[model samples]
Target chain A: MTTRTVAASKSGKLLNKLFPYLLLAPAFILVIVLNYIPIGESVLRSLYDWRGGSRATFVGLANFKELFQDMAFHISMKNMIKLLVFQLVVILTVPLLAAEYIFRLKNHPVLQNAFRVLFVLPMVVPRIVTVLIWQFIYDGDVGLLNGILKGLGLVSLARPWLDDPRLALYAIMFVGFPWVSGVATLIYLAGLENVESTVWDSCELDGARGLRRVFAIDIPLIFAQLRTMAVLTVIEVIGGYMFVDILVLTGGGPGWATMVPGLNLYENAFKFSRMGYACAMGLTLSLIALFITLLNMSLFGKKVDE
Target chain B: MRIRREDLIRLLVLGFLAVLTIAPFVITLFISFKTEAQFIRNPFGLSLPLHWSNYATAWAEVRKYLFNSIFACSIACVGALTTATLAAYAFARFSFWLDKFLFYVLMFLIMLPPIMSLVPRFLMVKRLGLLNTYGGLILPFMSGSQVTAMFILRSFFSGINESIFDAAQLDGASEGQILVRIVLPLSAPVLWTLAIMNIMTSWNNILWPLITLSSRELYPVTVGLMFFQGQYAIQRGPLMAGYIISSIPLVLLFMFASKSFIRGLSSGAVKM
Candidate 1:
């Protein structure tokens, strides 16, 4: 009986050691098969000349070479750069301003919560629906923007907002008007809440009033949150599928005016069956994203240390 | 007895911004209830004879896609949360040989943009014969979301009182029992938040489903709305109604679990 009990305890110890691995197996298997393998395959396939299904002949660097010379790709890159600048600016300003406003009303908890809920309410709407609603708003005839402009007696300025190539890209950028993103505002609010009451007391004692107080205390206190938002905005603008928006809104435009790199990549792979070229574009875009992210981290890391 | 000038000015500014933020949605709702003639007469304002039939027409078109979206998103959310929770528990509670290595591997994936693997993943899914099936959608979503879910869950699980876990272990409870009974119960709020975030992302996704599913029956609401818009380009009332109908599930989710929804949105910022 003693021997049997000892043997049972030994096996139980073995089982205890194996348990964590057993738990990890499911997620690991799925991640390996789905994410890691595909990423490896993407890197390999980008070097080959293949139409997705047929035998891929290795043509080293040719696809990348072609991508560099592609005029449409150049246009998309320029449009993306323009978009990135605009998005970063909007993200830094609008949501921070809104969060600061909400943060100032901390004494009035009821009003603070009300504003928080209202600001986040729009985010529950599906993004596609948001884009489509904007599509209708930018419609040539019987659209809200045009109707409002005409209502205000600015008839000359009420031309088809989306149909005009010069205005289409800007219109797409302006989809969520006033651009107070819920996520950004919430993040800033959380950051603002983290500031010690003692810090606030010192600022008040120093007589840092109005914009002086904001510039001196509020912005610096939320620098970490600002960095986070900046990085997120970069990833979003770079890696997001403007393909869907462009497809729904302009189909890359009245002549490649709004042709973003993501849409261009989609068109190459699926629409034109240039899968290899698309892979190269995807690789390039991802590298650019990775580079920018690292740059952002290092830059902010230095500032925070200082 | 009276509002301060500064406070009043702040209130006006915030109120004005709130109106601007919600104006598009409010306008969509009004237009959804208007007749085509009514919309044409006054595109930006409320009109008479609330046309409820537009919703019926829109519902007829949108119901299938909504069903597909709910079915797929729920599966993906639950699948991701379950797998991620188990993995996170192991990472949080145990110090095994491969623990640090595996954690780093998963963390590295968070930096790799999903768009990089788009083309190859599509090809692989096609080769596996999962293109139009629900598996193609659910599996990728589950895999893609696990890293973030695991990241969040592991941190939350780690912060729990270690003594409770030890006490449960000393009671001769197996690892599974300890997890299900102690860890999971302790971390319900975080799990709830993660589940809601997963569902919201799956619901909003368009590009993947659009590429994978060719059949009209398999289309999610996002893809369905695209085709719906194309077909109903001129029918403003029903088109606007379709947009609103597509949004109702998420809006309803927000209404019912506003606290969890808000928490989930903010928790996402904690990823970095």
Candidate 2:
């Protein structure tokens, strides 16, 4: 009886040690197969001249060499940079302003909640639908912008907003105009809410109110949220649904005006079947994203720590 | 009592911004109800005799896409939540060898942007014989959503009072039972928030399904809407109606669970 009880306790201890591994196995296995392994394959395949087949010939650095000289790739990179700049500026400022406006109405909790709900409501609309609606708005004829322009008799200014090479990228950027109706605003509002009441009291003692208080206290307090938004914005510009938007709207259109690297990579891999070259492009893009993410982290992260 | 001038100004600014934000949807609603002739006469204004038939035309085209989207997103959300919850509970409740290392390994993936691996992932799916199928769409979405769900759930689980878990353990409950009974019921709010967010994401996703499924019959609403727009390019009324039709599921979801939805969005920002 004594020997059996000891053996049972030993087995129970062993099971306790193994239980956590069993629990984590499903998640770890899925990510490894679906995410990490593919990432590894991307790196390896970048060096091989492989199509969508079993056979692959080693072609070290050739794909990367070709990528550097590709004019379309250069154009896409330049356009992506332009977009990154535009998005960074707009995302940082516009959402902050919108959140600030909502944060000021905190005393009226009902109105505050109403505004919060209203701001986040548009997010329910699918992104593709949003893009398509903008496509209609940018239509040369019978479009909302043009219709309004014609109504106001500004006919000269009402050309095809998306068809123009000079305007297409900008027009795409302008889709979510007054861009406060996103989760970024809510995140900022949440950050503002966490600011201690004593800070507000001190700001009031200093006679800092309105925009003055915002500059003095609120912005400083929400620096971490700003950093988070900035990092996410960078990652998004580099690799987000901008490609889908461009694909559906312009297809890189009238002379590669709105071409971005993600769309360029997609076209290479799927459309043109330049699999190796696409892999190389993917590596370069990921490296660029990583570099920027690290840079943003070090820059703002240190500030926040200090 | 007279309202303060500053408060009045603030209210006006908020109202104006709100109107500008919602203007597109409001215009789409108006356009969806107008006849082509009425639209040509006045594109921006609401016209008489609202053509409800436009919805019928849209519904016929949109229903298949809606069904596919609902089917795939539902599976992905449920799958993600299950795997992520188990993993989160493990990480929170137990400390084993490689615990921190494995957690960080999973966390590292959050930085690897999905676009970077898009080509290889496509090839991988093709190799697995999942191309042109719902598995191709649902599996990646489940994997992709795990990081955020795990991150959120793990933190929430860690915050629960340890005494409850201890009590359950002392009663001779297995770890699985403790998880299903104690942890899950306690974390319902977070799970609900994560589900809504995951569904919203998978529903909006376009690029993956666009590439994977060449079959028109299997297209999700986002991809299908693109084709629908092309087919009905000239028919503005029905096209606008289709866009509105596609938005109904999520909008209804928002109406019923607005608080959870809002919490999901805000907590989603805490990913970093």
Candidate 3:
């Protein structure tokens, strides 16, 4: 085997071993320097009080202390919990049902494929634009919601959906009603497809079809997908601000009713020039997301390869 | 020609949901053609005159921002595609003690939201004198795509028949040649999928571009549209028009590539 390459030396062996690293280096460097390194720096930056282009002054967790004391932050946290609960409930139910409904249309490939395409096609529209379109639909006077209510002769129920602080958060959450994401649906379908044919056949043979088969077999097998959606939504809600920011009527609202931690962190960083404070919130948010991610992996994520 | 009542019921329910899904875009399209006065008079109704001037006006307004977006996002997608392809190939084809460790590290980064490091990233880029330049905006976002794209592409690479590469190697072809000649050609679908995704993420990015590129000229359409809509808050017509301009390309792309695009996002749970 070594005959044709008998002249191989120390450098050749080293180069052979190092070749993979060389190929991997650019991405590794980019990720470390641009993505991962900043994470460490953020932790360091959060401990300092730097603002308005001033020199950094070490503050030793004062930012977090201040964050805890701030009542606005408190409201933001409550709002986030509220949104998270709503998001979790919707995510677990709607997407799974939609996927199941489409999956049951097994005999009709045309219909199944069409519904799948329709469900996912909206993804091409930039999320921000969707938020904006919903903003139009939620408009108090001339908006589609009010127009529909008026058309249905339930005009009394059409009062300023996004304008009322009590209604703003719910209205934002309602934007793309049914909340059955194409991604979640696809993941679920994939999981279902992985169910062994023999297992499914046996279940059918035993008359364990329909909802019973779904609850007993499909749901358990797809528990990993459900857990993934739960973790992803929580992280997304904590990081996202587009919806709240576009609540044009209630811009963090008549009373900070719709304010979320992500939006709050953003406002602090740029709008309030509280860079240090925002960094602290960033770290906290990261830790929360990290904790949830770990919880998911431990609880329901796929078993690790040895 | 006998239709089962159950099948009919399923068809009706499915069709309704499909309509509900497609309606928002349809409404946006019709409303986009309306003049401000017409919208005020009949907000939810069809655009009677079918005024097309709004598109022209919206184009004139957001063209600079659109150019900046295309420039920055495309460059970032290309950068991401290149780096992600290389790293994914390494992870897929080579084995070392550090391979699993490094792969997990990339996944860990993927899991961490950018909110985690938003400020420090800004400062680091600023310190490097990359602030406000297209590269500054492009680089971090490019790196952001590495984890997901690497995961996706690595899985794709690993699925390829390895004997083909072995044959190439036996002919004295280098790893680079094998990757280009054998791997790259086979990787078109995944590559296109990742490229489109990278482009979408880079284009849809707002918070990072907002923080990093404070200069008005360098703003992507998302940031520009945010500010523009904020400026024209009450001008619902013009605002809708701008939203139309921004959405049409993606909507068209989806109409064409919806199958593969949805497949890519669907097959993976960790979509951006």
Candidate 4:
């Protein structure tokens, strides 16, 4: 009770902490088992030329070489790049413009919430429902588009939208444009709301017209939202293009017109049972997506945390 | 504040958006009430004889899948919320050697595109005898999504003042007691936000469940919709009806929680 008691008294003034690490133990274990473990397994599998077999030869990088040789794989790469560009334009432009309008009208809560709910409905809707709904809209014989075209005296141009290889990818992209607009619009709404009302008032007082005020005050603040949306849209398109393969009724048909990376990866893994090759495809697509995301972050995103 | 010609243009643009947004659901609704014969005959037109019975039929067909989805969604929500909240509390309140490194690891996990690990996850789940179980279906998504919940909760918990923890400590509160009594009560809003977001994700996730759950009884509504499409390849009635039933919960959720959900997603995105 001499020195030991004195030391305990001094240290006891500090708060005792235990079991803090215990709180994190479960999450740490689960991620290791689920995510990192699979990543490791895929790496190991990538070294083998196994086709779901008991016996296989280890051919490191052979799968990558074969993937490069496949013409469809090359096209998938090109199409992915094209999609990244197209998405950047469509998703970025509409939200930047729409956020300005929504910001100007922020005083009206009812109208604001009404439009927001409507737009974001598609974002929340199950992907298959959207796909099926659009599939009906794009149908050939009795679709909404053809019926409207015929009614509007444009029957000459009413044609099968998904059957043509040249137009098939665009038709698929059409479905994406609206499905994603809701999230961007919401992001814009949030960004615009964050801009001080006084700033807009000042711009207005300085003879800034509607569009001019938007450019002068609104875009800069909302640019962060725009960059975030652009990266998300690119990643989404790359990951979500597989759903297009399901809905467009083409299954990347008319000679692989709408064959995006996800669909290609799916076919390779499941149908072809080339686990190694499929892993290569997945790794490649992920790297490209990562590169684009990093590029956008550096170019447009602010260094500060949100 | 005056209603200029430009104001009218803005309103018109919003009008166009309204139509574009709601048109698909409207189309799906109309076709859902149509007869199969009418649907196949004119997929785009009004039903020759309106047939609302298709909904009952479709529901009976996929009710098992719907039930499974509800069960799995609940499991994931509970699992994710508990684990994320616990870890977030530790990271927010404590000073530890590995805290920063672990936090950065969680961030890295969030950035990963899930499809990259799909093949390996499938193989692992299969080998674990969880191929068609509810545990298999919900566990992977829960594990994958915890990064987000941890991030959100960590941000929220760190905002609480340190004095509260000190006071609780002076009141003879143990770490477990402080967590249960103080931290949880103060973090309700963030918890609700995480719940709504996770519920939506659980409801809408397709690709992972599609690959893992092979038994029809184990499929979620998102994957179950694919079956509707497969069975009704030429008919739109059941297909449209399926869409209507499957999407009602989400539509209602959006209608009710639109503001909170939008704020959550935007805030989450901006942070990332």
Candidate 5:
């Protein structure tokens, strides 16, 4: 080959080596537009306090200072933390137990498949549908729950479930119960399925059964799945409360008992028309969420399936 | 042989679990046909009239919302699938210094909750002149690291043998040509799976649309249904109708594609 052709071939080889990077560029650019730039803008806007529109005054940390004095804000934060704790416990236990149970049924393929589908069905259903269905169930007067209780002559136990400040959060919590274990089940089931049958046979020979097998064999095998579910559940609890706002159906009222940061942020930005201050609140909430997620990562990120 | 007591207990447990799981959905299906008054009064009972027209009325009222939802969701799904596939393919088969760093960063992005970016995202969408536009709704969803889709696609893509690439090279196939002609044809199952997932993500997404879309005309089903929630003193009849209508397309889609979607969700469970 002549020098010209050889040079041309070498250049082509270089171009071929870079092709994947070139292909990835479009995705990277979109990420900046979608995630990076907006996050940067949120930080910038967090320092300002202005109404909706082209006008905002940079107030630095004053909005945050005002945040401390706001009782509603404090209640929202406390409620969020409580939710974060309660959800972690409930979501974690149900999934771990169910996943272990399902995994142990390797001999019953049909039942396993049916259970998987049934549990995951709720996740596929939209939140709006879920909220609407539960609202009827939570309805003060004519709800099936209340009706069933009264018909059974347990009138004292039946009350407006969503309206009671003490019980409203729990009403919101139940909305998540349907599909809460799905991801955990999926993860742990996968992990459990991958375990060599010989190991399980040995465990059986050791006379492990039910709760014993679960504690001794099953939990260790799927500790990674447990970690994954824990992190995701926390994120879901913090970011996922938006679904609860719909079910509570109070319009962030009944004395702000059902209000979470998301609804509060939405109201502040759109409903209250305090766009700049909302941005600040949104920024604060975002930081809090990010911190929680990061905390989860630092705690559990390294122990992934790898 | 006598059935063991343990086996009987397992059956009982399974039965109870199934009832718990399926009851809510059965209740929802029943309620879809019930009126607001009927729903409030007897949510569990059979509808007196079995008003299916509520579906029709709900559809008409929320038609724009449905259209907007379909439009936004379709665009986001298509965009996410296309971009994620390309990125995933590159990450799966190719190696370079930047690849590992980019992959790790993407993983970090996945860990960051969507709410963390809500305000910033809204501002960016507004500034880009995409507010209330399909592009704005699509971009955040389609491009926001889409970690789950990328993970699924990457795992599937990596499973293909290296010999295929060598064989394609011997045939004088370009990289893009191999991706399009060979890899894509073989990866149809996963591609379709991710497509369903992307569709679901876009369809169920409410928070992003809540902030970005200003006009009623731009409202998707999730936001559109909110209109009926308060506008007529909680018109539960039309609202239930609206829920039924919005849900029909999704349910139909899932009924046909659920097997693959279930496989996909479970397939990535190992990674998650």
Candidate 6:
């Protein structure tokens, strides 16, 4: 009402308007600089032949051209395609089935909690430790897999798992045996839990039993989870070098059987000092991810109920 | 207490699946306690003369890296939790022009695989003279987990009854005061949740440090253990022992917080 109070109220309004930006600037700014800029910077860096700061010549797309011709790159792309196809099929079905079983435990909260904990348990183990344990299990002399095989009197079948290129990549895949019952299971189970009991009762009245119930009722209900799991699995494979496993287990060989582009990028940038080339690989990977994300957005759409 | 035949069958099948999932870890634990000679000779079965000393040697080998892990993860937890809490409070409470846009931008970053940005980030750090230091390791981790923490914390902060803030404002509390004295005090559970998560993640992180840090001095327990394994590949007993030691902290954390962790993840998914 008074002049001083009015001046104070005006300043307070300005402060109220500015306060959110002040609060957001710290972390929002950090995330932008660290995450968003790097993507654009990677594209820019890919255009140059930056040989470890010794010589950075802007060669434009030449690195990408070289990437296409590079045999290792080709091998990595092939293996990635193989991994993606294999993961897509397995990741979708196995977890959903696991969730279906877990869903049946709706009557038993304690049992359900215990199993849920157990399912996501392995996730908490540092990925390195889990990968290394599998490494030991694949060791030639005293590895558990071979040891178990021999104990079962399959002496001829027991061989150096990691030592064989053909088996090494596949061996790594099976490390988390029945890997289905992890976070994916939890997601699907949550989706299943959200379904109306009336829906199930009507299906039961109609005698929509077993697989028919699942195919007709369950799958459609958990469709969002299915799509999400697919996108997440593909993106993770493309980005998660799990190459550390290769580094410890087989080092990408008997040959380049397990080589993935993610690892290739690491080796080029750090080991070989081919920063520009690695940047090119990084950009290609981002573009692939972006393509998949856009495709998922279109397929899954912006709404959940839909 | 009578079980239906169908329920009994489900229980049995679930138990079997659980065994199949857990057998390897139990077997590895059994192996870690064995002498190397015993492991090689009596490979699949438990034997006499358990070699518990393998843990001692493994612990000694990795103790330095353990400290480094603790240091880096703690720094990361503090830095990340602080930034995320502030940003999350703003997102939850404020209606700036860019709030929705910034929120989606953060969401977009969430879907991006960090490895896409790996090269440029490494270069950015190196150019800024942070490579091979804790700063390089901690900075990326802070960014990597920011969106997730923000998402979780924003939901929590937004759920706080608005009357508390209104009352606090009437009592002459500033925005900073409301955040620190009011919102943050009520947010301990979520803050601790994010703290534990960030610690677990940064502790397990390997790829970024693997690329950035060339020196052993900066190696967190994860990368250091990898080097230790590579160096002593033939020492299976010690390596297995080391793996067990390294995993114990995280496994213990998981056992305690699996409920909250699963809830957080599932809720986050539903929100998305």
Q: List the residue pairs that clash in candidate 4.
A: none
Worst ten-residue run, lDDT, model 1 chain A?
A297-306
Q: Please, what is the whole-model Cα lDDT of each candidate in the order they appear?
A: 0.86, 0.86, 0.79, 0.75, 0.73, 0.80
DockQ of 3: 0.56
Tens-digit lDDT string for candidate 2 (B1-272): 35567656767888888899899999999999988899888787788899999999999999999999999999999999999998998999889999999988888776667888888999999999999999999999999998889988998888899899889989999888988888888877678778888998899888899899999999999999988998998888999999999999988887888876667556533434
The C-alpha TM-scores of every prediction are: 0.96, 0.96, 0.93, 0.91, 0.90, 0.93
Q: For residues B1-272, could you state the per-residue lDDT of candidate 3 as single tens digits? A: 45566667767777787788788878888778888788878776686888888778788888898888888887888888888899989999999769999888888876788778887788789888999898899889888876788887887888899799889999999888999999999877667777777777777777788778878988988888878887877766667788878877766766676666656655552333
Any runs in candidate 6 off by more than 4 Å, and if so which? A1-3, A303-306, B159-173, B177-193, B266-271
**Which scores greater on DockQ, model 2 or model 5?**
2
Please write out the lDDT profile of model 1 over residues B14-68, one tens digit for every residue: 9999999999999999999988788778776888789999999999999999999
Task: Name model 1 segments beyond 4 Å from true.
Answer: A302-306, B264-271
Better of 2 and 3 by TM-score: 2
Residue B106, candidate 1: alpha-carbon lDDT: 83
Chain B TM-score, candidates in order: 0.95, 0.95, 0.91, 0.87, 0.88, 0.90
The candidate with the higher DockQ, 5 or 6, is 6
lDDT (C-alpha) at residue A176 in model 4: 41
By DockQ, the candidates rank as: 2, 1, 6, 3, 4, 5
Top model by lDDT, which number? 2
Q: By lDDT, highest first, what's the ranking?
A: 2, 1, 6, 3, 4, 5
Better of 3 and 4 by DockQ: 3
> Model 5 Cα displacement at B98 (Å)?
2.9
Misplaced by over 4 Å in model 4 are: A1-18, A176-181, A240-248, A300-306, B1-4, B36-50, B262-271
Q: Over the stretch A1-306, how does candidate 5's per-residue lDDT look in tens digits?
A: 699999998999899788888878778888877777766776677778866577888888888888778788888888777777877787668766666666656667787787777766666666676776677777887676787899899999999998898888777767645443355666667777778889889988989888878888888886777777777766666665454354336655567777777777777776787766666676677666668766766776573324
Residue pairs whose backbone atoms clash in candidate 1: none
